[model samples]
Target: MVNLFSHNISNSNAINNIYNIIYDYASLISGVLSIIGCSLNLFLLYILIRDKQFHTVSYKLIRISVISDILSSFTIGTGCLLISYEFTYDGGIILCRVVIFFTFTSNGVSILNLCLIAIDRYFAIVKPFYRRYHRRRKQIFYLSQIFVWTIS
Candidate 1:
C-alpha cells in the first residue's frame, strides 16, 4: 500500500492508484505488521496451550516469549491505531515513561528468553558431561524465568 503511493511520482515504476483516503505510510505499515505479528503469536500461543506435546519446561519459556511478543505487538498496534485515526493524544511525561518502560521491558524479556534457550542448547551440544552432571530441576528454570521478568 505504501509502495502504491509512490514518493517519486515521476518514476516509471510508480503505479497510478486512485484513492480518496490518504494514509500515513509508516503508521499503516506498523499497524499492519503489528496485526500480523499479534495474530501469529496468538496462533502459536493457542497451539502451545492446547497441545499436550508442547507442555514442557522449554515450551513454557517459549510460551513466555510468545506472551511478551503479543504484549509488544499490542503496544505498537495501539499507538499505530491511534495515529491512523488521527487521535491528538500527545500523552505527557508519565504516560510516555510508562509506555517506554513496558516496551523496553517486553523487548528485554524476549532477548533474555532467547539467551536462555541459546545457553541451554550450547550446553547440551558442547558439554554433554557437564550438563549431565549439573542437571537442573524444573524449579530452577521457573526461578530463572521469574528472575528474567523481574530484571527486565
Candidate 2:
C-alpha cells in the first residue's frame, strides 16, 4: 500500500517520464562531447608521435594532457551513456567508485598539466637567461611534465 502518512506519492509516472527525457538529452550531449574529445586527443597524439620533430618537451606535456582527456572522456562519458540507456543503478558500488575516481583524477591531471604549461611559458618569457644558463628548455619541460604526472 502507498505510504499515505509519509506523503510519498504512489504514482511516480510524471517523475519517471521527466527523468527519461532528461536522461536522453544528457546522453546525447555527452556522446557528442566524448566523440569530439576523443577525436581531438587522437589527432594530437598522432601529430606528436608521428613527427619526430614534435618530440620537444612542450609538445610532450600537451600529449599527456590529451591522453588524460581521452581516458577521462571514455570512462565518464560511457558511464553516462550506460546510465541513460539502462535507467537504473546497475553499475554497482565498486564500478561506480572506480569510475568516479578515474574521472576526478584524470580531470585534475589535465588541469594541472595546463597550469604547469603556463608556468613553463612564464619562465621562458620572463627569465630567458635562466633557460640558457641552467637546464635546456627541452630538459626542463620534460622534467616538469614528469613531475606533474608523478604528482597527479
Candidate 3:
C-alpha cells in the first residue's frame, strides 16, 4: 500500500511539473507579445504628439485611448504573466490593490475614450450643425476626457 501511494504521488508530481512547464512557456509568449503591442502603441502616440498638424479633437481622443492601452498592457498584461509564473504578491495587500486599481482604471479609460470618439464621429457625420457647435466648444472635449479620467 505504501509503495502504491508513493507511485501515485510521483505521478501527481510529474503532472504538476508538466503543467508548470506549459504555463511558463505560455506566459513567456504572452509577455513578449504584450511588450510588442505596447511598443507599437507608444510609437503611434509619439507620432501623434510630434506632428502639430494632427492636433485635433479626434486625434486627442485617439491619443488618450492609446495611452490607456499602453497602461493596460503594462499593468494587466504583466499581472497575468506573473500569475502564470506563480509569482506571489509578497509585497502585501497595498501592492495588489494598486495593481488592480491601475488595471481597471486603464481599461475603463480606453473604453470611455472609444465611446467618446464614436459619439464625436456620429455628430460630425449625422448632424453637421451639432458638429459645428462641438468644434466651437472645444473645451467640452477636454472636459469629457478629464471626467473620464476622474471616474476611472
Candidate 4:
C-alpha cells in the first residue's frame, strides 16, 4: 500500500505519500458510505410516500433523518471522489474549502438530526404529557431541514 511506498521514499516524499494515502482512504470510505446511505434512504422514502398510514410524527422524523443522511452521504462522498480522482485537487483552494465545509456540516447535521430523533422518541415514550407537543412533527421536520441548510 501507500505506507510501503512511503517507507521507500525520502522524508518529504514520505510526507506527501502519507497525505495521498489518507485522502484516498477518506474518499473510499465516503463513497461506500454514500452508496449505502442513498440506497436505504431511497427505500425508506418509497415506503413512507406509498403508505398513507405511515404518515405519522415518527415517520416524519424518519423521513427527515433519511434526507439528512442522503445529503451527508453525497457531500462527503463527492468530496472524497474528487480528491481521489484528482490527487492534486484540481478544484483549487476555494473548492477544497467548500468541500471540507460541506463534509463537516453534513456530518454535523446528520448527528444532530439523530439527536433530535432520540429526543422526539424520548418525549413520545417517557413524557406522555408532551406527546401532543409533537403533533406538529411534520411541520417541524420541514423547519429542521431549513434550519440545517441555513446553519450549514
- lDDT per residue, candidate 4, 68-118, as tens digits? 677666766676666677655456566578767766776677766776678
Model 1 pairs whose backbones collide = none
Worst 10 residues of 4 by lDDT: 86-95
Judge candidate 3 at residue 91 and give its lDDT: 49
Candidate 1 positional error at 43, Å? 0.4
Which consecutive 10 residues in model 1 have the weakest lDDT in total?
12-21
Error of 1 at 152 (Å): 0.9
Give me the candidate number with maximum lDDT.
3
| Cα lDDT, all candidates | 0.77, 0.75, 0.82, 0.73
Instruction: Name the better of 1 and 4 by TM-score.
Output: 1
lDDT of 1 at 37: 93
Q: Number of clashes in model 3?
A: 0
> What's the C-alpha lDDT at position 89 in model 3?
62
Candidate 3 structure quality by residue, lDDT tens digits, 26-124: 877877788888899999999999999879888899999899889877775676566565555674355567668987898899889989888888878
lDDT of 1: 0.77
Model 2 agreement with the true structure over 10-123: per-residue lDDT tens digits = 347668888889878987788778877878888878988999997755567788888898888787767666666654455556557876887887887888888877877677
